[model samples]
Target: MNEPCSRLAGVAVHLPETTMTTAELEDAVEARSPGVRIPRGVLERASGVRRRHIAAPHELPSDLAVAASREVLDDAGVRPAELDLIIYAGVLGDTVEPATAHVVAAGLGAACPVFDVRNACNGFANAIDIADALIARGGHRRVLITCGELLSAGIPWRIRSTEEFFAAGPHYTFSDAGAALLMEAGPAAGDGPAGGVLATRFSAESAAWALAALPVTGLSSDPDGAPLGIGRFDYDSLRFAAAFNDLDLEVLHKPLVEAGLRWDDFAAVCVHQAALPYLRAFCDRAGIPHDRTVVTIAEHGNVATASLPLQLAEAVRGGRVRRGDLVALVGLGSGIGAGIVIARW
Candidate 1:
């Protein structure tokens, strides 16, 4: 028997009402460390993020996911009880035990097989990949993957000096947001590649995992452990950027090769956006058309695992992507991993 095609059935996103501008963050930096000589506009110039959504202190990461999940479930007209599986894929969670997926499931009153998938920023894309496989092989008819990222919670608001500023700068480039995507089995009522997910490819460079992290060690400490405590944003952004200096285009080429498609074939490509410059650089390195890609880094900031779908939602709403339109989701996250999911919207 042939594998049943799994397609993106619905998508929804939730952004916190609060916002923090780059200039405001810079002001806070200078206010906290008066002696530091961090220049204004430098942060925005480098990060390409002007502002980002911020969750309220009372909001938990699970809340973000639940909000979006409810919207998606309603949009898809699929009841919680009808879902075959549920996956909470994100970097932030309410706690360590009980699995964040369970929180999301309970929030929606969903009673089905559920789990969590955490791969730093690539969590959502990877979750979609896993759900696609499960639907194709496990006979699960409907799978929901949700991501809730409180990336701002990791930001070290108090900087002591310029050196400290640059090292922790990566923390400021993100915003808090929730995203939910529904994948359903079987064909659709469109002309999109005979229905949903067409191809997916994943690659990892584990050795380069040290590029960035916000570790919370229980009993032990890392060799280069973050002395500042949890959410330290312990990474040298400069070295990390240089690591991708020699980026090979194979991350993208392999997908096209396997799926028998071309770069131009996609209506809009949604690449992970930790920052605007990196997104642009990756596109340039991959030779993908500049206009063909969506730009959310500047406005949304990096929404972490929710980044791809947020951009995708914007594209579809704006008419840049239509039903049956072919779209590609590219992910590049801290674990130093990459993945591409080709689906017909």
Candidate 2:
């Protein structure tokens, strides 16, 4: 028996309405803390993110997912009953109890077996890998992968010191968005000059997971009085960069080898939008040309699991990718997990 090839059926994105500029976030941070100050344009300069979309107060991650899912299903012309699986892959869910996929499935009236696949930001790509295997095994034909990240909502706005603000700066680069991809069984030969998934590979660097862990529960002082159970975040940017370099070659090599492809084979590369600087550095190390990658961080910020898919959607729509063009989806996230999926589009 041979592995079945999955075709790229459709991709879509749903962004929130509200936009938060760097200056606005800076002001919000400064105003909430009595003695803390963040210089104007600091975040913009550091992250290359001019602004980020923020969800409405009443909007949940599931809502965004459903919106994107609808667009994908409609584009693919796949009915809810025809879907074999639905995987909600994102950082935050509507509830910690019921799997977020459940809510999204209900919204779509999808009766398929649904669940969540979380690996920080690598979720969408990871879900694809799972779906790919299931398809190859012949149990499933169509799988829908969706992600909605609302990381911006988790920013603790009460920090009162330079250290706390700096620790939280990474949070500032996050945005809210949802994206979806539909993969279905297709002829392997169609990937050439047509859209299909060629191969996918995933790897991890668990040892470096602690370098960029986020939103851990901690104590914070309120201006009015007592301590509050606000979430705190910390990141060692230098350490993370070093770890990426250390593992870069191996991570990319295994995938290319297994797929029997080269970095130059891709017409465009879409990676996790960590930040503009880190993204550039990663591209440089991987020997992928700068122009060959599509970046959305400057305008969309780091949208977590939605990053890669959002980039892919934009690239496809913008004509950066054409039929038979090979595109690489590289996802790197906390837990230090990484994965790559090569598709023809």
Query: What is candidate 1's CA lDDT for residue 64?
Result: 97
Write one digit per residue (lDDT tens) for candidate 2, span 129-238: 88877877788899999988888786767887878776677888889999999989866535355446767777888988888775534344556655443344567877
Q: Can you give the TM-score per candidate against the true fold?
A: 0.93, 0.91
Relative to the unseen true structure, what is the C-alpha lDDT of residue 293 in candidate 2, on a scale of 0 to 100?
Answer: 88
Maximum-lDDT candidate = 1
Query: Which candidate ranks first by TM-score, i.e. highest?
Result: 1
Which residue pairs in candidate 2 collide? 193-324, 322-345
> What lDDT, from 0 to 1, does candidate 1 have?
0.85
Q: Model 2: runs farther than 4 Å from truth? A: 1-3, 189-191, 215-231, 257-260
Candidate 1 structure quality by residue, lDDT tens digits, 1-345: 567878788899999999989999888777888688777887899899999999999999999999999999999899999999999998888877889999989889989999999998888888998998898885799999998999888777777888888767777787999999998987642454468887788888777788787777543556565454354567867777776665555877887987778879889999888878888888888878888899998988988899998999899879998887899999888767888888888
lDDT of each: 0.85, 0.83
Q: Clashing residue pairs, candidate 1?
A: 7-196, 324-345
Alpha-carbon error at 97 in model 2, in Å?
2.4
